[model samples]
Target: MANTSNKVREFQRKLYLRSKQEPDQAFYSLYDKICRFDILWDAFYLCKANKGAAGVDGVRFEDLNSIETSGKLIKTLRAELVEGRYRPLPVKRVQIPKDNGKTRNLGIPSIRDRIVQMACTLVLSPVFEPHFHCNSYGYRPKRSAQDAVICINGYLKQGYQQVYDADLSKFFDTIPHSRLLDKVRSKVTDRAVLRLIKLFLKAPISEPTAKGKSRIVGNPIGTPQGGVISPLLANIYLNDFCRKIATKTPCKIISYADDFVILSKTPFNSAQQDWIKNELEQEGLKLNEDKTHIVDMTQVGNEFDFLGFTFKYIVGFIQHTNYVKIYPSKKSQKKYKDKLRSIVKHRTSLTLDQLVERVNRVVRGWKNYFGKVGYPRQVFFKMDWFLVARFYRWSRSRSQRRSLYLAQDAWNKLHKAGLVYLQPTKMKTAKVSR
Candidate 1:
């Protein structure tokens, strides 16, 4: 069983690297492998339980079938794992020898607060169109590569139009650690907190590893290049920057993470841009110019991506297809069910009727705000589709009465988007309201 798991990990890594190169083809291949693996793993588990082989039971032989059925085994295996009852694995702690008799533990929040105060802020530009892609999980759109282009064009539009863009020297390492620490100490007047900050400065360690090699660990300092908290932290810092700028001049700051677009109505001026750049320099962050651009109105494209939603030149021209859809898979229905099961497992006490109330709550909000925007079918997104389908199934699966609120919000949202028409679903306990 361990060996089988190891092989699965190996395949996942190789596939991950390959997918980075050829995402489209690899997505299909990886998706198929995951599906097939799930089916076989389930079969093997049932067979082993019947055979009384409580342990390994030579699951590797079945796993070897991973590449079979056009790698259907691998696909099934991953899906099962994602949906399986895997317990949280224990983490290994590393011991680092102290230089003297004292060691300090710097709490990230303490240091982060200080970073925000001392660091200069940057007001990024607003997202316009074609700059971001959709993420179904977060239920938000993300910036696309072209969005970067629009960012530069936005700057140019305001008259900081420069023909050249440049990169910073030692962008990441140049952050002034000593100054940052000092700033942190000033913000939090606790001695113990200061001690922690002091220790963190001297003992910056690589991120904690959970399992497996080749995992990219984050460098300390609360900046997760791609983690959830990173954006919030960056936003805090940038907000301070914008406040400072707004104090001295007029500029609006808008951002989705590090990517920024600043609007200055003060005419096309390099001085403001320069001052903005200088402020960022004080804190260690720098803009990459090789990727930056400056374009006039003619150069401005009609669409861009910002804040996860695609912006088109025309009002109400958001392309929902790029933002929401069930992922490509043969067992869409089953996968969707598994998701709902997990949701219910976590929320053990929620009754079907209560769930109905909750979903309807969100639906009510949708109706009040976006009710008249588009057709009911267009309103519901992939998230709505999956959630609604799951709740409907759950209501039927359980003999006890279940509520229907869970599906209500998603359904109404989907309906407003013109994706589906109004349909009444019969719940166990009561008649679910649309």
Candidate 2:
């Protein structure tokens, strides 16, 4: 009976906190009952219950309408509630939350923005420019391939060239918050956070929504936008590096945000590589040496895959592997070959299934024609066969959904012949219908 009494009291206290109302004897009793188990989740449940307690009793709804200090606090509270950060003291009602549409708010500008905007515009503009991501992967590579050709053309005009690839070391974490906030102050006109920042030093911090809740320790990651000046700050850092390197002669440096590639026409000799390495070290960015490769332009092909496109140091000589293995394990070989044939048929509306009886036949044939010029995966011996089937489906035409297999057969014949030479012409349309 004594144990039961203690339990009841603990539950009442927890319930009181959760309710967000003034602590009363009854609430304390409930709070006492809950803490007995000593489980951590019970603490969260208690916190959730306490969220309902925030109140404004004497202040009437009409008083809240006035656009003054109280009104701003209320607005901030409302915003917090919508963000799932606000909790009233415990309440009995369980209801699904609704999204109250609010216009997006960009915060005040800071020194960070000023710095970044200036750098990208002034220092980096001469060399690397922002590149846009294409919508579709299919046509994108071919276009990017063309762009590589243009880069090669530029190199030839300038002289001989060497390329070095780089990535930043903890780029985002190094930004200064106070400097960032300077930018935020100008952009953010939101009634709440702005007001908070304005009177921050003097303001009484409401008890943290829960114990141990504190400000974020490091810079945030993976957000589209931040308080106001994050992008400007980031771009400024990029520009700073660009400006320093601008003075360096006889080489070209290009960057897409942090991923950078440096090109110089000098020979792939040790002196040129060492010179380029020292220049990058002067800036904050570091090159990932293991992934980096020096392409010899004089060799068979200079083409390599970077950021996605297969950039041939030469263009036509470089080959890419397709997903399906022209020769998989003995068990899956037939299946893999069939799928590749399906994709080829779908491409040109002609079937070549009759010309190939085994995986070896298809493997030997496509390599002879396309070589390194196939899809992202190679149909090489002992490769994953299931990938080939997937590629066939992915490459199939959206219009041919109704008769995919039939379309595949048709595509293969045209692909092989490079012309509309469908053998057994009457049977072609017949196979499609069935």
Task: Compose the digit string of candidate 2's lDDT tens values, residues 68-181.
Answer: 743354345434534535332211111222223423212222222211222212211111122122211111213332343345335534654455555554444344444433
Candidate 1: lDDT over CA atoms?
A: 0.37
Model 2 residue 252 distance off true place after TM-score fit, in angstroms: 1.1
Model 1, which residues run further than 4 Å from truth?
A: 1-175, 200-240, 255-260, 266-271, 290-301, 315-434
Which candidate number would show the highest TM-score if scored against the true structure?
2
Superposing all C-alpha atoms, what RMSD in Å does each candidate have to the true structure? 22.6, 22.7
